[model samples]
Target: MLENGKLQRSLGLWAIVGLGLGYMTPTVMFDTFGIVSKQTNGMVPLAYIIALIVMLFTAISYGKMVRIFPSAGSAYTYTKETMGNYTGFIVGWASLLDYLLLPLVNALIIRLYLESLFPSVPPWIWVVSYVAFVTTINVLSMNSTSNLNGFLVIFSILLIISFIIFASIQLYQGMGTGTLFTMQPIINSNVDMVGVLTGATVLCFSFVGFDAITMYTEEAIDKNTVPKAIFLTVFIGGGIFFTASFFTQTLFPDLSVFQVVDDTLPEIGLYVGGKVFQVFLIAGAFAATTASGLASHSSVSRLLFVMGRNNMLPKKVFGYVHPKFHTPAINVVLVGLVSLFAIGPSLELITAIINFGALIAFTFVNISVIAYFAVGQKRYKTGKDIFSFIIMPLLGAGSTGFLWYFLHADAFIGGIIWLIVGIIYMLYLTRFFRRKLGTLDFDEREDTRAVEADVKVSSQG
Candidate 1:
């Protein structure tokens, strides 16, 4: 048993990876396939490839930062420690858009799936029920959440494999393209660069799970496990997205078959395997959404708890960890309340809005790497240091910036308004620069070492 105000360190590598995969929601490839395919003119796989490359560079930066500051705060902690408190607060506030809205996104997707299956039922019923269930599970304990998420993630992956097999068989029988291997999905005569770039921007939302795994650092069994988990989550999630999109795009090769492009999972399933398969696909989708809801809800609550613990938010509400459950109970409930808003928004609107904040967080994490290592630590003297601390992160930052060029207009407007609100609140928090904002203790390494030693001793005894 552990004391209050501390997250338990019980998660192993695969456990962390499971949570990451759960957060990524492997089944999302189907949900967004028709929309992306329409935008890219059946080049969904190409967009995924571009998004994966961008996320890989950012994932490298995340791995480096986690080794230095192993805290639940993630991007906020990294930015604050490396840049300054004010900037850190802004980045964290922006990241809240990604973390907070993600659970809502899951709820929205679930509502879509449920409404498709049961047309007469009201959408709010699905959203409210899902939010309540996910919140209850997350408020219990981290280990329970991880275990449940792991099972769901595995089920979702198996379903993806099933779909791929069915699609492959159809292709071999001259159903759509008649060939499994072709450049049609990657490039064709009608390929548009702008459309592909826009598709890539939207697809970036799928890769947010890799960075989200960093939030579990405080709950990980070993601090070193985080860096490895980050890489695994990125590559594994990317592989799933790319492979699924490739086959689906090849099989359909166009959006004319999908009645609804925004949510095409059901139609894809129906066309590929029939009505029975559609039911199974919906079940898989629900499982995937539930797993993602658990992971995202848990992650956002932790971020709130960390901010509250540092006095950035209301310490009494957000920072209060339940002594019995050892989880951020209040924060968990708070996220659930926010997720109720899913009853109103369109899937495309929410998705584009999420990309705004996500890109900001990704861009800064890459910059934070340079700020911490190259500028602050002066590690730019050696060639290896220059490559690791400077060049790579710069590439990451530049690539992320390129994505921003294609951000939706509504997303930019919404993001700026959120940032302005954050700026006002931050100003009041610090008394207009008259006082220093509260910060996490910088002696995390020494503290981690002491805790590890204590655990070692206890286990031996």
Candidate 2:
């Protein structure tokens, strides 16, 4: 039964981790491997390794924040409580782009994959069908959505593992690269920093899902569970990316051999496992995309719900939860409506624009950690605090700052325009700074000593 008409704390560690992995979509590494290989001179694993290192730091930073403030607002709450309301609003606005575009990107990719499999079907059909289905699942129940996500994620991982096995067999049997061991995928004489950084920026999309875990803080069974799940999600997702891309690169080391960049993995499937495996691979991609879409839908609705509950948006519309379903039905519908925009743009443009918002949010999230732990509380007792609170987050901010600086010009412009619009709207909402900001029900600070004690006991035991 629902308690006090709030989001039910139904998600345990595994379910939350499953939702995060599903959101990241392990199959995406295959979809973009060819492009990354070309940019890095076939050093896909090395670029992924670099991206993973940077992402891990941000993941730790996020884990710290979730421990401090377990709420659905995520980066917004962290920045607001630590930095200031104005700064938090800006971070929240940037996060809006990340959460909202994720589903759009997944929905668009679903249509693109379906088109590749069946060229005659209209693209809008797949987009509409996916959006409606995912939106409905989200509106009904988070538990139902999580169960569906868990099943799909397991299936997708199994398919990728199958491909790895087949690829390894082919390598041993003198196919494609004709050897199991090679260093070309990690380094080469033609290695260029610019290309590696560019590819790393693109590959960052695959790491996007881990941060979404924080959006479910209000719905988690245990506040401590969210932080552990966040770290695990990033570690597991990064492992899949590194392993799958390594084997794929080992099998298809020559980028020029690809007939089409996006279709590279499917083509390699045909070569190693023949037509049947190609069909299965396409099926796997479809499953992965669906799961990712569902995860994204769930994440964005919770974000809108938190913003609405805070009166940041129209609370009457975005904040309303269903009496029985315990979901933000209006916000769910709104996400489905906005997802229609995916039909107007190319995949490259949409994905590039997404990176801009995500990188900005990441930079601020890392900064928020420093502000909260090191500056605000001066929390430096535990040995882990020095590495996690001080050194690691600083590196995360610096690395993400570099990526933000080098974002594609189009993405930079789009992000700036979006930020400008947000500033104008916020001004109106606050009545030109004359009115104070509204707070959510769970906005009050918790007893840090008690919370930290609980977290420490949870981890130690």
Candidate 3:
């Protein structure tokens, strides 16, 4: 329950990490391995390595912002406070696509995996069921969702470990590739830089939730824990993705051999562990996807809550916090309602669109860091400060901007249309920039300050 009309202060380092991993969903490697293998010419692990490096710069920028401004409003808060309210609103509008479409995509993927396992069940039933389940958990409370997320993440990790062990045994027995460790997956004869980079852009989607831990800055028991958790999530999630894809690719080195690329992992399960293990794979996929959907739902609702409270959106609907649960009850339900559109299922095109929003927000996050510290405050005292505040953010902006440059044409066009819609809406909000509305006001609400103090106390004890 709320101590005084504020969201509960209940999460810590591990819980935040769990939520991040749940959002990233290590099973993403399983779902898209075929495409990554095709694009990278079997060097899927190399693609992930490159993606991880690109994500770290942006992650560091997010960590800095969280330390300076620990609020529920993530990129929106950082951009608006430093770059003016208009820029922040645009960045937030771009990020809304990332936050909103994530759960819908997860729900659609969950329906696909379930239908593959049980052909008798209708698709819409699964989508509604998953949406309702995720929304209910989110509405109950933050701790409730975090605890469940931790448990599911543990199970997902164990399942991947099992795959590695079984695959090792098969290699030892002279099956499939006849060797456990081979450079074939990383150093294929058909290696090309263009294919590898395109694959890297696609795999970058796997790292979407690394910044999500910052959304919980207000709720984290120790404010310092948020940054560490972000790094841990990236490295740990990267490690799992790298390991799982390495073994799977080693077992099936040639992409041309498979009839359906998407069915690669399920077939590997059958080969190594029989029909029962295939069933297990299906179950594990569902659990991982559902866990991701739950985390995505939480992040999106929190984003809406912050925007609603700022009067950027309707405060009554988006800003209403449940007195009993201390959660954004109405926003949670609204996200679930929006996720119903996933009933038809369009994975590749929608995924590209989601990545466009993420890249835009990530690029601006780096810019905001530079603008706030280097230009606004002029506080470059030490070598560490100079590198952290200036050099790092510049590299981050360049890296994400490069990715945005190479985004699929369809995705770029769709994102531009979305931005145009947001621009028109911003005109309505600002009265065509005539009123100079939405000027930044840094006052913390009394209840929010109370929750922050309580969280600090909890951390100290």
Q: For each candidate, what TM-score against the reference? A: 0.96, 0.93, 0.94
Residue 212 C-alpha lDDT in model 2: 90
Residue 25 local lDDT, model 1: 89
Query: Which prediction has the highest TM-score against the true structure?
Result: 1
lDDT of each: 0.90, 0.84, 0.84
Candidate 3 residue pairs in clash (backbone atoms < 3 Å): none
Best by lDDT: 1
Off by over 4 Å in 1: 1-3, 449-461
Prediction 2 TM-score vs. true: 0.93
List of clashing residue pairs for candidate 2: none
Candidate 2 structure lDDT: 0.84
Worst 10 residues of 3 by lDDT: 435-444
lDDT of 3 by residue, 306-338 (tens): 888788887778878887677889999999999
Which residue pairs show backbone clashes in model 1?
none
Q: Hey, what RMSD does candidate 1 come out at? A: 2.3
How well is each residue in 177-271 modelled by candidate 2, as lDDT tens digits?
Answer: 68867787787787888888888888899999889999888777676899999999999999999999989888888776678886576887787
